[model samples]
Target: MTAALDVKGLTTRFETRAGHVTAVNDVSFAVQPGRIMGLVGESGSGKSVTGFSILGLIDAPGEVTAGAVLVDGVDLRQLSTEDLRKMRGRKVAMVFQDPMMTLNPVLRVGDQMTMAVRVHQPMSKSDALQHARKALEVVGIPSPAERLKAYPHQLSGGMRQRVAIAMALLHSPSVIIADEATTALDVSIQGQILAEVRELADETGAAIVWITHDLAVVSSLADDICVMYAGRIVERGTAEQVIGGPRHPYTQGLLDSIPARHEPGRKLPQIPGSTPQLSRLPEGCPFQPRCPRATDLCRTEPPLDVRDGQAVLCHHPLEGV
Candidate 1:
């Protein structure tokens, strides 16, 4: 099947006083229609940068140096700024971590959504409002009509997030990039949103790029997983393959740190050393300094080892038990 979203050799860099820092390095992945691809990593792992790069949202000081962001076989990088802006909400959309980033605090939910609808489509205000109500309903928001009349601050965090998501779906975009969309909500609310997202994917045939640091979230919600470290993808596989049997040391360390994976009351295992500064990354594998399994071979660039459908960029990948 053709990918709804395909990213190839995505590289983004930042120009700092010290030097140029590569925030996203040769990252590549594809999400087929109705599938969710989890881009899981640590805070500075460039997963978020990848999301912004895909949407052409990278600003000054940080720029997407190379790559092709293809949505429905159209390369977004080839489009002009105006064209890209038009494509953003119509063919592809993004839900930011903070709902406020997408919502206007002063505007009523219905008014904002109506404006969003009319931005790309020439529609009457009443008709646009109807579309907004339907979108809210699609995200499982109750009393959609009433909720639309309320201001953003009047709703709870989860409700605000759902509204943001609903707004993203107003155009029926083929690709949706969600950057930590549910991180602020409580677990129960997060679970509820995840369920709704899964349903949205199935019903709308939209490919979702779920960017998060939480393996647990994606373990249940994603069809595929990509583990990133130091702006590079370290592993890629089906959710089952990556979570059940992580091959890369970095991936293993992340799973091991999850509380549920350990016995009660025991201290969790952690990958030693924090993420290296982008400008100061080591000569070869960036994770080598923290990897217990590292050897002389790890000091140089590691090979991409593929077994079954799982791929790990490591000289010594962990064997499945």
Candidate 2:
């Protein structure tokens, strides 16, 4: 089956005054229609950069140097700016970590939402407003009509996120990238938003890429999981395989760090050492410094090997079923 989104050998780099820094290195993944894939990693892990690269949103000093981003078989890099702009809001949408990134504080909520719909769609003002109102309602906002009239500042954080989501759904895009979209909301509100997003995917058959640092959130929402470290994906598989039977040391470290997985009195286990600076990455495995399983062979880069359905990049992957 054709994928809704297919990314192959993607590498993004930033040209800083210090030097060129590789942010996303040879990353590849696929998201099928109506399915949710979680891109999980810590801060500076290039997870967000990969999402931005797929959307062609990387700014100056940073660019997609290699690889193809195919949306429904069309290579996005081959499209012109005008074509990309048109494709973006209509075929693909991204929900950013900050609601402000989507919401304009000066603009009234109704106008913002309606404008999003009207941009890609040719509809009368009244019709667009109707569509926007319905979208707000779909995202579980109460009194959608009243909420539309209020400015973004008037709504709470959760409400603002809902509005952003409603805007993303305005055009019924085929793929949605949520970059830490629910990170700022309270647990209850986050759950509500996630549920709404899941329902929307099921109803519309939209593929969803949820990028987040929270493993627990991914475990709950994603059908598949990709674990990244230092711009590279070290482990990827079905959620059950990645989360239940993690093989890479980095993946194991993440699972061990989760408080709920530890004994009540024991301290949470953290991966030793910090993420290496991009320009000064280690000679072999990026995780070698912190991995207890690292051996002499680990000093040489390991290929991503497929075992069963899991893809793990580790010279000394934990041995077991």
Candidate 3:
């Protein structure tokens, strides 16, 4: 089956006083309809940059240097600016980390949502509002009609987020890029939203790319997983394979750091050292400086190793347990 979204060899760079720093280095992944792919990594690992690059949102000082972003087999990279803007909400939509980033402090929920719907589709205000109300209902918001009349500040954080998500659904986008959409909510509310997101994918047949640093969240929510280090995906596989049997040392370290995987009283383990500075990354493998399995062979660039539908970019990958 053709992927709903396919990203190939994506590379994004920022021109700084020092030099060009590659923020997203040859990253690639695909998501099929009704499936959720978790793009997991530490901050500065390029997960968020990858999301923005896919949507053609990279600006000034930063440019998408290479790659093809295909939505429904059409290369988004080739579209004119006006055409790309048209495709953003109709074919793909992004839910930002902060609901406020997508909401207007001065506008009522209904007003913003109806505006969003009418942007891509010419329709009567009432018709657009009906679409907005249904979207809120789809995301499990109660009293959708009443809530639409309320201002953003009038609602709780979770409710505001639900409104933001509802707006993303106004167009029934084929692909949704959610950048830490649930990180701000309390655990219970986050769980509720994750469950609703799963249902939304199944019901709407929308491919979702969930970008987050929290492995615990993705372990429960994602069908597939991509573990990133620096700007590259070091490992890609089903959630079972990546979370349950991580091959790359960075991935293994991330899994080990999850507190739930350890005893309650014991201290949590952590990946040693921090994410590398993009411009000053090591000569070869970016993770080599922090990787325990690194050897002289690792000083040279590692080739992509594929086995049993799992791929790893490591000279000495851990054995599948």
TM-score of each: 0.97, 0.97, 0.97
* Tens-digit lDDT string for candidate 3 (1-321): 999999999999999988999999888889999999999988899999999999999998999999999999999999999999999989999999899999999999999999999999999999998999999999999999999999999999999888988888888899999999999999999999999999999989999999999999999999999998888999999999998899999899988887778989998887778888888988778889888888877778764455457888888888854
Point out where model 2 deviates above 4 Å: 302-308, 319-321
Tens-digit lDDT track of model 1 for 1-321 = 899999999999999998999999988888999999999998899999999999999999999999999999999999999999999999999999999999999999999999999999999999999999999999999999999999999999999999999999999999999999999999999989999999999999999999998888999999999999999988999998898999998888988888987899999998887989888988767888999998887788755556456878888889743
- Give the lDDT ranking, best first: 1, 3, 2
Q: Report, for all candidates in order, the number of backbone clashes.
A: 0, 0, 0
Question: Which segments of model 3 are wrong by more than 4 Å?
Answer: 302-308
Candidate 2 per-residue C-alpha lDDT over 3-81 given as tens digits, one digit per residue, 9 for 90 to 100: 9999999999999977999999999889999999999999989999999999999999898999999898989989999
Candidate 2 lDDT trough over 10 residues, lowest sum: 300-309
Give candidates' CA RMSD values in order: 1.4, 1.3, 1.3
In candidate 1 the C-alpha lDDT for residue 4 amounts to: 97
TM-score of candidate 2 on Cα atoms, chains taken together: 0.97
